[model samples]
Target: MIIEKLLFHTFIILAPVLIQTSLLEHHKWSKSPIFTGVLNGLATLTCLAFTYEFAGLYWDFRYVPLIIAMVYGGRKAGLIVLAFMLIGRTIMGGDILFHGLASAVIASLIPYYFSKGFWKMSPVKRVVAAQFIGLWPIAIIFLMLFVFHLPSQFLSELHSITFILQFGLVQVLGIGIAARLNEWMVEKKVMREEIIKSEKLNTLGELAASIAHEVRNPLTVVKGFLQLMKRQSKGEEDEYLAIILSELGRAEEIINDYLNFAKPQFEKVERVHIKEILSEVSILLNAYAVKECFFGEPPGG
Candidate 1:
């Protein structure tokens, strides 16, 4: 009977993984905060529904789902699952229902506080932390029962070292398995996305490089012509050629930015002379000024 119940509880605990994988495959919002809350909420309710009794107190791995919700999904999920547990257990009519709720509240806060950085934790640390949080709630509930001087039968159950060890081990292993499964799911999703993104980037880079090199050939020819013209032309014509050359230089700079992603090499950063940039700006503005009649044959033009 014990083995059968343990197998049943394990099934109930792992049910979410199959549900989540199906949801994700169908592009549903399986990882959404509210959705996680609801998923774990249903799991906790299932746990509460099938609760067993021993040691003169009701037993369920309700905290297993609750802690998973809090650690992986944050406060929103924690609250939702807690609500489900509270409602389900209340309907079940336990002798110490209030103790269950009180211990949940006290233990839940600890995981919620740690949830903010839980995702950043290493996989092993996350599993360990979740197990610790799951078991801590039971300890709190036990202490509460002892402090209140539970009826003789309950106290006697509490004193059974074998039962305490068995129960504690169950909570620890339950949470550890659940946490590791969740982290594995998350990592798989990330790896899949990276593969898709890399493929798209590779296609884009090849297309861009082909266009850039074709475009650069004509730009180079025009630039050479403009430079030669600048050297030979007089006064006003020389100034105009200088402006054209500066504009061509800027166009080449932009083309280079696109070509840098050609897969052979990446973008390079180089110091640009501000004074040269300012000189180009002044030349363009002067040409505009002359064309707008702000100057007729402006100085140096």
Candidate 2:
């Protein structure tokens, strides 16, 4: 009979896990906190409907779903699912109804705390922590059974170590499976985000390289004219023409850097002259004086 009960609970516990994993793979519901909560709540209710009975006492892997909801789904999801489980258990009206409610609360709280640092732990540690938190409710239920002695058969099973061990084993297996599934889902999400970010960067790099190439040709023509103007200018105007030529050269260097995205290995390795670069950059506003004279309406007009 104990073996039969174990087998029954095992199926009940594992079925929801499989369903949850499938939903995670195929649906966008996991991205929304409210939807995730609703999904978990429904799963808990379904598991509760198939409660395992032994020695006139009933229990289910309901808490396993609740724990998963809280730990992976966040506080709002946990609370929402807990409320659903409470309502369902209230309707069920069994000898252990209140005991089950209390156990659910404990189960939810345990994982809530564990989740604060859950991702920091190694995979093995995560599984161990999940199993421990999952089995804690069972221990709580046992204590309630012992202290209340309402079931009458509670005392009979109170000293049965085999019963406790079997239940613990079931909790460990159920919670471990759920935890691993949650970890896998998290890993897949992170990998997907990374891929998306990499694609965006690649697209931006290509766009930048294209824009830089287009701008460089016009800039080169402008620099050639400025150089010719510098050669023709006299003393006072010579200084001004030199500034314009240097500023145009700096602009070309900037465009060249942008183009380097297309062929980074061919980047210029020569040391840049910091003073010359700074002088060109500093005189950029003065270069605008020449630009205004060139493009703006004549001074007399």
Candidate 3:
């Protein structure tokens, strides 16, 4: 019977986690800090609503969601989720409401203060730290019970080693699962960026190759004509010929630089009109668009 309740509650707690994971996977909203905070806040509220009943008291992996929000989403997310939980608990109005509110505040701070250090820690340490941090809220609630001099039955139920250990284990497992999911999301994002970069580099290489081939042919023709002019020039024109030859050599060097995938540096900087570039691009695109449309039309029409 005890094991069945634990399994049922575990499933309830994880349902939101699965939904949250799917949201992260499908939507780009996670990139926005505010949106991410609001999303995680909703997840925490869901966890709260599905609390597991034990010994006439409620327990849920509510802090698990908040910890994840703060650790990965930062202080903004933590505070937002905390606010949601506190507001919901206050509205519910029970003897444990104040205790729940205090625990929620502590839970928010644990990740806000330690998230940076948590990420820096080894994987084993991270799991250990998460478990410890995750369970601190329950610890606080128990302490508050003693402090408030709650009824004997309430104290007795909480005081049981079995209850403590069971709940502690739940916290540890939930934290571990949340932390792993966070790591997986980060890895997926990084992998996507890397794939995009590789594709861009490949496209750049193809463009460079095409430009080098087309430009080299025209440069070669121009150089050949200049060499012919130099050979036929008189003494007075020789200085001008030397200047022309030198410029042609520089142009060849620029072409070679392009072929080698290096940026061509100009000896003189000149102001280029943006309108001229736009006009050139427009003309080129207009020709391609006309050709494509001409072919796209029906044979009879």
In terms of TM-score, the best-performing candidate is: 2
The regions of model 2 sitting more than 4 angstroms off are: 1-11, 14-17, 23-26, 113-126, 148-159, 264-301
Ordered list by lDDT, greatest first = 1, 2, 3
* Root mean square deviation (Cα) for candidate 3: 13.1
Off by over 4 Å in 1: 144-159, 227-301
Estimated TM-score for each candidate: 0.72, 0.75, 0.69
Question: Which tens-of-lDDT digit does each residue in 80-190 have in candidate 1?
Answer: 988888888778766777876777677778877888888787888888888877767778868875766564756465446556666677677777888888888878888
- Among residues 3 or more apart in sequence or in different chains, the pairs in candidate 3 whose N, CA or C atoms overlap within 3 Å are none
Instruction: Candidate 2: give the clashing pairs.
Output: none
**Which model, 2 or 3, shows the larger TM-score?**
2
**Counted clashes in each candidate structure:** 0, 0, 0
Q: Candidate 3 residues 1-301, lDDT tens each?
A: 5555655555644554465567557677656657666766776676677666665466666777677677767777777878888887787778777666876787677678887666787666676777677776777656765666555766466456576677778667867776776666666778999999999988887788788778888878887887898799888787887887788789778878767764544789989999999999999899898987887877677
* Candidate 1 accuracy as TM-score: 0.72
lDDT tens digits by residue: candidate 2, 48-98: 787776555566667776777776777787788899999998999877777
